[model samples]
Target: MQLDEATLRIVAILFSLLIGGLLLFSWNSNRVNRELLVLGSSFGSAAVGIVLIGIASLGQSVIYLYTGVTLLFFAYGGGWQTMRIFERRPVKPWLAGLGGIFWLALSLIDPEHGPLITALAVAVVPASYTALMGFELWRGRGEYLPSRFALCMVVGLDSVLLVMRGVFIMIAASEAHRWTETQLTMTLSLLIVLVNVAVGYLMLSLIKERLETEQRAQTLIDPLTGLGNRRALHLHAERILRRQATSGQSVCVAIIDLDHFKKINDTFGHFMGDSVLRTFAERATLKLRPVDYLFRVGGEEFLCILQAAEERDAVGVMERIRRSMKSYRIGEGTEARGVTLSAGIASSRRVGYDLEDLTRAADAALYKAKRDGRNRVCVYTGDDTRLAADVEGRAWAEPRPQAGPLSGPQLT
Candidate 1:
């Protein structure tokens, strides 16, 4: 079979355009969100191939050839960042620097040898990337999930494509220094291009989906305490309330505020204060029934909604949390000591109302607890203005009244 220079040129131009478009898009995207160096590398490699084999000019190849070298360096930087994401020790960037220099030598030494070097370089880069991902997986470092798995698959596929290209190079070299049969080369190239694009799409889709899912989870969780934020808590509590209303089960709510939290912040610094709050939350959560839900409304304030057999169970839970926090250590020095939590326990029967009303009632009881004394628990039954007024008047006596996420009650 005869090789057609015209057809090969068309194929080269088409692939170059594809490569250019993707590289341009990746460059723009990297400005906004940087972790797409692999996209750029793929385009850069293909573009060099186009210049070296397609146009067949030394001047043009020099420019594109350097582009490929630069891209390899960029990918190595990306891989370093990728290593950080997995908390692994980063390899020296010079490893990639050396690889880039080697590729440059290969590209400039002889134009006739360009295609073979291009194929080998393409395989080497993706193989390195795949190796990075695989190493992380092997070490059991980071969240080794489907997204990383897909990335491995994509890089591995690129290596196979490169190897196939190398096979083409060998065939051409064996056939009396002539180009490989154009028909066979075109068909195989088309299939490889199509498969690569499809795999790229799959990897992109999986990563995007993973990112969106994580964002959603972050939205629903309290970043500091790892508890449900007010939004998530409200949604969950409302669902539980609806179920209770239908099944006629008992439910209770408790509002908890750390006593003298501001003093801890002011005295020990916000970092230490944050430590105390997080520790308190962790201890408090462990004391709750699995059916119970905890929420961090805001700084040093949390809520526990309990689906219980009766009001007594809720009171017991509140007491347990209060006691545990009183013994909980703050800071990690010779001065490390204990902190306390004040809580208000309110039941549906006591409030004789829905989850929102019960929450408000718990807040009222919390005021009474603070008014009477810090580190105590109270239950709401009647109008709480007097207790709340007294607590409000104390000023420095309370923890400066750091409000929860929701200042006033809202319907759930």
Candidate 2:
């Protein structure tokens, strides 16, 4: 077709309709993303709005023109609403409707400058919302999805262009570029086509990226406790070891085994056992520092990588976790039973910076705690005297705590 304003408007309408249908198809493929629905509504409304505006030009019905343009304002509102939904924010459709009302009021007051007045009045809300949402997306650049960020930039730049166009019109003492051959009108037409393609691609990219991210996370996370799995634990251990070596800071690996966990599972059923496991994971995580990493490396056993200066700090951390679990109870009322945890800490200062070595030492100490009547914190001291003294082969490691002796549940 011809490249005149009317032809360009038709092209824009076609683009909006095609994009709306395609995005709606994508949305149907995965109805979970509500933002897709809102985004589709925006494009659908844009097409309808353009059609009405075109019809109003050829006809004398002011009502048709006003309704059509109001829908256009709603279209802009829909765009802003899409962003709000995408960001997991609250939706306020009324605000955009309010802008449409303002636009309608101005159009009724002065028909000659009505279009200009309407554009200027309702533009800020979508523009501002778009820019703000883009800024939020920009802040999340660490997500490593450049298309998502680029989409934000596109929206923000479009808003700026619209705002600048308004200012230029007001300052030049000229009529708005609705009918005229101006850079603003041409730029807008170009942008409409560009934005339609960009939005479709970026929205798809964001959804796919999020899905991949969640899938990757699920592989490394424990389903029952929501703690890191054995693989994740190993990865974290290697990272922690490198950091410790560079800083000359010692690290501690603690192996925490829930006392008689299998018995609890058998007595109370696996359902109750699962609840206790979740409770323990939650409580233990709260007890540890942000730098300390905890992982559910096995059934009823958690591994902790603590950034500590000395051996004592690791023991202290385990003590805190043990005490925290003392009050943690599953089941309600009269039948509520409390759970206890046993911990074994192996310090990098003694075991060197190897994860396997640290893990072995921690497991050894944990075995000692299990032997010493469970529910106690044991630490691996450099002296192998305690393990050698376990002549009866009661436990694998030392009987005493490496840092300071803990009066465990047996003492109380």
Candidate 3:
């Protein structure tokens, strides 16, 4: 097959971009290091692709043989590692290696016949690897969410190109009837190679997008508590407000503060103090509905946004959160110890109201809870009356059934 100089240049450039993009993504060390290994193998594949392009452009028999051999090595190695990544025992590499040896022998015997086997190997190896990749992704389908989805899409596209490439090569070598007259068999082959190069670039782009999304998620999440941080709270509130304004949906904002938190820091030391704070938020998280949003607004202060069916429903959710947090605990040095919490609830059903207004109401209720004495739950009604009352207080109301239990943050 003879590729035009212009077509060869385009294939070479696309392969170069694929290699560059893979290398760039590999430099980001935040993801599991094994993924970097995968990216490196992909880069190796791109390098082999470039070499093949160079051989095709020059029409050098020896170079083409070398390129075929190199690609087989890359395919086997990459496919093997990718299997390991998905926790599958590597299978395709052995077949691919055997196929590689077969093609090398065929190349020596007859270059014309060798293109048949080499093309078959090229097409089959990637096709098999792509199949395994799909299965691997499906097995761990939702384990990493959108990352797996991106991988599946990328690999699926590559597999289609791989199969198409094989058919193109087989037809080019053995027959010339399939392609249009203007589309030379060589040009068709080059076009298939170009498509694969494009697919590889697209894979790299997907990886980059996943990494960027993770970084963005990290910025919004509080590392210690695993809850939304102040920034996330603000952004989420803005979004909720926009939605509510358009749809007239009810939104409730609740404020929570740990009673006598400084005492925990002073008595237990700051490490245990942080643990208590984190545990409080974590426990609160379990009690929230999926539509409800929790945030670490400040030191020992949290805000929850509830998509409630009604104001009463929102209060009930906050009550559950209060009870759950009340039952959470922090370890006391070597021994586990229990802790309690206080929360102030507030909400706004009306659209176009500022988030700060709800915060003020919740804060007022929280202040009243503190003033009524420690370890109490209060609700802010939009009125002159303070929500704090002695009988309604439920903090420290539930005693731990066990004296010694693993406590504090629960390790996630």
The candidate that wins on lDDT is 2
lDDT minimum window of 10 residues, candidate 3: 403-412
> Stretches of candidate 2 above 4 Å error?
119-126, 139-144, 164-184, 330-337, 383-412
How well does candidate 3 score on lDDT at residue 174? Answer: 53
lDDT of 3 by residue, 234-291 (tens): 7678777677657776677778887778887887799988888767765666566656
Q: Write the per-residue lDDT of candidate 1 for residues 1-412, one digit (tens) a residue.
A: 5546556545644664575466447547655333344444544555455444444333453565466444544444444344333333554556545556777777789768765665556546544654554455445424534566565555456556645654665566555453344466556555555654544454455446556767877888877877889888867777777777678777878899999899899878999887887777677766676667788987888988787536556666677777777887776798676888778877776565487788788888888888887777776756542322223222221112213422222222
Clashing pairs in 1: none
| Two-way TM-score contest, 2 vs 3, winner | 2
| TM-score per model over all chains | 0.55, 0.85, 0.67
Q: Which residues of candidate 3, in runs, are more than 4 Å off?
A: 1-70, 73-123, 127-165, 168-183, 329-337, 349-352, 386-412
**After best superposition, candidate 2 residue 304: deviation in angstroms?**
0.5
Arrange candidates, best lDDT first: 2, 1, 3
Model 2: per-residue Cα lDDT at residue 317: 69
| Maximum-TM-score candidate | 2
